[model samples]
Target: MNQPWSGRKLHFVGIGGIGMSGLAKVARSLGAEVTGSDRAQGGHDARNVPAGATVVFSTAIGADNPERTTGAPELHRADLLAELTQLKPTIAVSGTHGKTTTTSMLVHAMPGESYLVGGEVRSTGTNADWHEDSAWLIVEADESDRSLLKLHPTIAVVTNAELDHHTTYASSRDVDDTFAQFLARARDAVVAPDLTRLRADAHVFGEYDGPLAVPGAHNRKNAAAALTAIEIAQGTAELARELLATFEGAGRRFEVVGTANGATVVDDYAHHPTEVRATIEAARSQHPPRVIALFQPHLFSRTQREARAFGEALAGADMAVLLDVYPARERQEDYPGVSGLLVAEHAYDARPGMPVIWAKTHATARAYLQRALQEGDLLLTMGAGDVNAIGRDLVAHSEPPGR
Candidate 1:
């Protein structure tokens, strides 16, 4: 009962991604045949690919990964669509940001057998599996490049609508238009607080007015949306509050490491502006001695696009340390002259009274904090990349010299 997958063949395109990898794990746990493909030099194989199941992959496969070619399955992302067409699933999860977290929550909360495909593995389960008699099919619906349109789910959840992926959309309106299409695909759609602006005849969730177990008002809304989706899809909310209350939360999303030398070090995988604001606001609610943040930007285009907003969000912290941008699969020139310094500069403008933010290498950022930190300070390392190491290293280094 704890594991939902019970032996179905599941194949994932972009299997190495956080959301995709999580779905693979949920599927494999149900005893389904799980397989996956990833771009060349995909990182984190141990986390992404399931232990047992045939894995056929190629970064070069493109959209051609799913077609059966002379008895061999095509190794492309689109080829998986053909495969999905052949195997009609029960449920799918799709969204830009909160898909992984929400899908993981649903997998953890829902009872009975289910099949799931998402971008990351949330719980301690196999990376991918197959299930024959799943009550539902769970997936992370991504709107980037209209990839989510490929899925037709009984229920769809849009975490929130934000101005992201400037590389594709000319404006935020374009992003909204795409999401409206995604909402149209599902018989019912569940959306969070901010994303309510999207034009969808979809079902609404997360509007329940109750004190939430998760920190931040945003998470409360996320819980509500999730509960609503479950109700519409499964015919009962079924321990929704209890499940949300018990969820310790996925890794690296507000994960608190041990306190050392009177300083508390926390880490989160918040890269976008809204997420940054929400996370900082949550930390502020803790009534800590002081909040000190060390942030690593995720991508060049993202940084350049949201530099001003990023500044406004981070200024909420009492103190700030900005690190170099973490450019995943991008060239440095893609964002020339854009770095963590810009964020610090922008933050300085927003919070003039707060100490001017500092920019440092990961090592130097740690060293600066080690020298300046005081008792009762909250040190947060925020990013979607290796910046998490700063929090770990900071905690290790921040420890009282002897202990």
Candidate 2:
């Protein structure tokens, strides 16, 4: 369908972000002329920016950004979503984790459905798709910035509630309260049974018995949530189960980047302590010879808040390698200690014989991993930040053992 922004020129600041890029792609698909600039040096310049284009940006972009200072009309990603939600029947998938995977599963179950997932779906090679004929619009609702509160969804699905994003919430109670508010706004809702504090009438999903292609018990829960959401949307649960059985998984959620020297390398976006533990458990369930986990802590605030918990979670792995924090939008000076050091100290304290190594840089970590990985080992790169590159680089540089 033709959106109101069709035929208009749009430019995005911090366009490299998954959500921003998804919006840009959808706008372009709807016939809007789209361009964007990121912090990537020399990636964008005034020469390429179209004159009088509407400038769009996310919370991550700063005022000093060259593209943002162009004096063009500004738009926030949340504003765009708010507008779109008003126009169509919306289904918002929310939670501290599994938002991306569950949203992708829902989209996969309903072919040709319009969706804006937080991460790329490997099966589709894109994070967002705009289907003109479909009346439904599915979005991965981000609770970090409380943007999910802005969306007026006809159906809302909460995968699970947890205390993260300390910047937005003061405590776990605050997080649960905000989620309750979001759910209250929805006409119908589906949620994990653990989140029973919210209204009980909401469809609560438990363990799914249907076939699943993705590994891990968490994925089964994700599938169950997706199936319940599909049923709420008037879709068949059986078909969704069948599609989920063949689901290849979304990008960076236990994504097998490649294998080298008989060792399988997997990458996952699991930065939180709970997520880290779950990902480690998933790796263990695969019964690999050894699971060597390489983790990069995402934000300084998060690391500061959950350092001990992060260390405890890393104990689940046979061996652990910690990389310096990614510090996405935070300044290092603002935080007390380096995330890697904090996690390393606590991890060693928690698991004395677990063999934890603090590789302060990518080069150091790569070198250490190359020499350490043995045949039949499962090398897992876990984090929400750029640590996924480690697995990709390993895959690109190493050859099969027999080769």
Worst 10 residues of 2 by lDDT: 40-49
Candidate 1 lDDT for residue 332:
86
The model with the greatest TM-score is 2
Q: TM-score for candidate 2, please give it.
A: 0.96
Clashing pairs in 2: none
- Model 2 agreement with the true structure over 1-403: per-residue lDDT tens digits: 5467777998887788899989998888778899877767447555556897988878777777677676778888988887778767988999988989999998888778888998888778889988778878989999998888888899999999899999989998999988998898899889998897886789899978888878888998998898888898866677777788788889899998888677999999998999999998999988998999999999999998899999999998999999999999899999865668899888889999889999989999999998888888999899988898888998898976866
- Using lDDT as the measure, which candidate wins? 2
Candidate 2, after superposition: displacement of residue 351 in Å?
A: 1.3
Q: Which stretches of candidate 1 lie over 4 Å from their true place?
A: 1-74, 77-89, 113-131, 192-200, 206-208, 401-403
Give the number of colliding residue pairs in candidate 2.
0
TM-score of each: 0.80, 0.96
